[model samples]
Target chain A: MTPQTGRSAGPGVPRGDLPHRAGATGWFDTRHRHLGDWAFVVNRLSGLGLVAYLYLHLVILSQLARGPEAWGGFLAIATSPPVLLFDVLLLAGLLAHAFNGIRVTLLGLGLVASRQKALWVALMGMAVLIALAGASRILGVTS
Target chain B: MATLLQTPRPGADADPAAPARTLRVRRHRRGDSAEGWDRYTAPVGPRTTVLDALTWVRAHLDASLNLRHSCLHASCGTCGMRVNGRDVLACVTRLEDLPPGEVSVEPLRNQPLVSDLVVDIESLYESLDGVRLPLVRTSEGAPGSTPAEGVGHLTRFEDCVECGLCVSACPIVASDPEYAGPAVLGAAWRLVAEPRDRDPEPAYALVDGEQGAWRCHLAFECNEVCPTDALPAEEIARLRGILLRHRVVRWLQRHARPEEVQP
Candidate 1:
């Protein structure tokens, strides 16, 4: 009996010509979502967000070198409620990124790498706890 | 043979009169053909696995349906395919785990397609050949003659079954064909980590390239899809750590002993 070959191209046709489909995205494929994958996605997004915020913060701080008037004008906008809320978001992103970074480092060190799911849960739990505490302090919601 | 193929689901209520389930297999006539998929409805029950359905279809409905499976159990690792868009072992995946609609079966990814539901896994094995995997014991001691105190508990490192499923699930291998995949790298780590292996330098050289451990994005899909719990992603991470440590040591040595460092 003739075997049913999966590929239909002739010998002369290059393999590259065939349709080659990778994951749903280059790295983030929602179709193959797992717990570890979700963690990776969150870590990547948070890291990028933190890097962008770093550059933005530096740009804003550079205005201080211009003059007191310029600095005071920028500070006024920075201290606004919307800016404060954005700071809170940045704080949450920073905490998540930092904690997840620690988790990845620990995994690299082979510390509790076998129980990665548990480690992720524990790190995420810590991130949430720290973010909540920081948010409470930022909003003056103590008590 | 059909009776032997029946694998009852765990804690599943036995139903003798269950209705038949459909196994829709995606077919490609050649590497560039446009033939999409072929559907086959078989008399499936709770005990039927994806492999059993394929076998039934081949034996009864379409004799031309090509698939490969050796050990009906998960040991042989020959029946790896995509079921419902996820890489899985056909011999072990049960019908109950699939959704309510028709079960879809496709060939494994990151490899050349041989036929319907059959891929060229020899490419994976060929990649392993470049790593030079062999126990390199330099000491002229007999087997089991060396001290087994700390080395006895290293069974976790030797869990690679070389199924190629990890290669299929690995995104790096899909994106970059030159990248030595998780399975081969995991095997390299296993060989290198063995205390009895006196010469691990070759394995180190193999993994110290651009397509080595650094290429992995730590997606952890290989660990998730492995049926034997090999944890290849963990092994790759350990390999990266080892490589990083070696690089650091070499850098320090070069800086400290400038006379000994060769240009």
Candidate 2:
């Protein structure tokens, strides 16, 4: 389909004379082209996951409602290698989602117009933090 | 009757200006049939509008031409048609101003097409109808009871012609089928933001469900294409802020209740 043109064209040239190009060029281009949509979708899904984690953590903490035996079992399940790995993954997704959301929020608020590089930097920072904290906990360096 | 004196004729033939170029308009013959372009000659003039050319074609060239237009001016808001693949007011688009070539006219996208160059706008109208575009009045006295001294900001929002260009151009509408879309939200924002709108609580609940303003990711495509300067992005943003604040306030109120408080 031809791109719409207005009286802006010079005489004798048709609007569709120009080559047809898709709105997006490649995978990277689409990611940036539909950045708002992608960001919203990723943020919402990750937020839901984080909310689930919050509820799960609250429930595990509510083991205080039970005796130490129950709390011991819950902690064991949580600290198991697989569960710990999943937790790390969840934390990574959460941080990425949140930092990206904040970046978008800043852009939307006009607090920052040239936010692309800044968004990447913020996301990388979150990844580093998540990796460091998760590795330290898993390697028994700290709780 | 007295006989009048006869004058001699010198001209053997008279020729007027050459006919202007033919404009090929797409005709949607059937509900399921593919659309085809049908050429119709039009008089070229600097000030001639696309709507005028279409009207001339319909009147003299093809009476079977199907299109919806009303109020040759933009105020009536009915003459919105896609000119050259973009949504524009046909009445306001002068032919001479367009590129000197074949201009493709089509029905508005993301909506049902009733016929050539006419899309069903009832869906948008229904969405607007669904919004409770008013604030409840207090029992003591009516809101806006004082003389309607117009505030420029609020009153300008009321100038929405409901042309649906914003809706057509909106990326949200393209992605989410259930979105109330920009036109409806634009109208809703007018009432929601009105200074005299009493009991704004109702406006908060009006858009809670699927594809409401919350679905809008602040693309601002609606704001960019609005024929009138009704910035829908600003309005939707304000609505989001109001709704979030209201929820937070309600949560605080509930938590602060005496029964919920522990000594």
Candidate 3:
């Protein structure tokens, strides 16, 4: 949380979290938000989830330190139906975040600002199709 | 301001022939610790605006109910508020065009509340001043129209209207109070795009930083809620490109030999 530059509202006058202003925690408050709002919230959430998964993955890979028996036991748990279901969801999150990230970067660099909504829909559509294919491959083999 | 303390309009709650709707308005006082809503049932015809409904409430139901409006048109931008969770000018938002049901009218978000349905707009104006863009411009594409006797072009005052609707609709502004929001950036872009008689490089320099234009996440909610179509999101991106190209040129200049100075 780096410090922001000084604001014009000055410093001391408290800016109250007025209702319907969608405070810091209200990014996901989807009453009448636009598609870009939803895309932004989804991107942030998926990024956070991915970061947490990275740490868990390192710990899971540490099973090798306990010898071959421990590693095999972990692999058995990993291949179960519930674990495979989690994998499918994880793939969806990754694809959604990655594709939207590309769109955000392109727009931020002033590439295509006019058709941003259309660009978002196109990128997310591709993400959905890829996620569906990956989910079928993962779940179908398990079942 | 709505005329208050007069005899209550007869059709507010008693008439059986006129159409009516319930308005769920957010209420807050200066010293109140929390906020809540007060529902007022007002007699509304098809063309009755949200401002008209609110004024009706002030006249017939609750005299203490507070709001602000000047020109009973969208040009003033003083009647901005959220109707059905979207920012709009209350003077133009007719009841018939809104989502059918009890309409929820809340004050603009992310700013301090002065009273019911009116936020303290001092900060919004202060932010505009910080950018230093004169809020006036010539109307575009008004060709073949008459100009003043000595003037070359017919000029219009402004289009942005200083409504703060873009600021309210922006999520970045909601999260980071210091972020130079859509309206400011939009003005900055205009300054840079057409400097007129003045240099715009300083205006570009003002917004080259993180809290300036780079902080935007391209939500484009500002563009959506902007009543004037100023397209702040697009302008912010343009500002970023200018800053990026300037930096690249400076870098090249630094690394170039003394021959680069001969030109």
- Top candidate on lDDT is 3
TM-score of chain A of each: 0.81, 0.61, 0.81
Q: Tell me the TM-score that candidate 3 gets on chain A alone.
A: 0.81
Q: Candidate 1 or 2, higher lDDT?
A: 1
Candidate 3 structure quality by residue, lDDT tens digits, B1-263: 12222333576344556777888888775555467676777877868999998998877778878899999988888999999989899999999998778899999987777888998778778777766665333543357665444232111214778888888888888878778888888877767655567677767666886678888988888888888767788778777776788788878888889788436
Write down the worst ten-residue block by lDDT for model 1 chain B: B1-10
Candidate order by DockQ, decreasing, is 1, 3, 2
Which regions of candidate 1 fall more than 4 Å away from where they truly are? A1-26, A30-32, B1-18, B33-35, B135-159, B195-198, B244-263
iRMSD in angstroms, per model: 7.2, 16.5, 12.3
- lDDT for each residue of candidate 2 in B1-263, tens digit (9 for 90 to 100): 11111221222221135235456676653332345566666665657788987886676557767888888888877878778766788888888888887666666666666666776788777776666455333332355555334344555565677778777666556645567777776666666666363554545555444666677666555565567776676677666665566677778777897876555
How far does residue B16 in candidate 2 sit from its true spot (Å)?
Answer: 5.3
Q: Candidate 3's residue-wise lDDT over A3-119, tens digit each?
A: 223222334655553444567776666568888888888898999999998899899999999999999999999999999999998999999999989988988888888888899
Which stretches of model 2 miss by more than 4 angstroms?
A1-103, A107-143, B1-22, B132-150, B195-199, B259-263
The candidates' DockQ values read: 0.27, 0.04, 0.26
Error of 3 at B26 (Å): 0.9
Candidate 3 wrong stretches, greater than 4 Å: A1-21, A141-143, B1-8, B11-16, B134-142, B145-158
Q: Compute the lDDT for candidate 2.
A: 0.62
Q: How does candidate 3 fare on TM-score?
A: 0.86
Cα lDDT tens digits, model 1, A5-49, are 534567786544223347435456647657677777788888889
Top model by TM-score, which number?
Answer: 3
Q: What's the best-to-worst order under TM-score?
A: 3, 1, 2
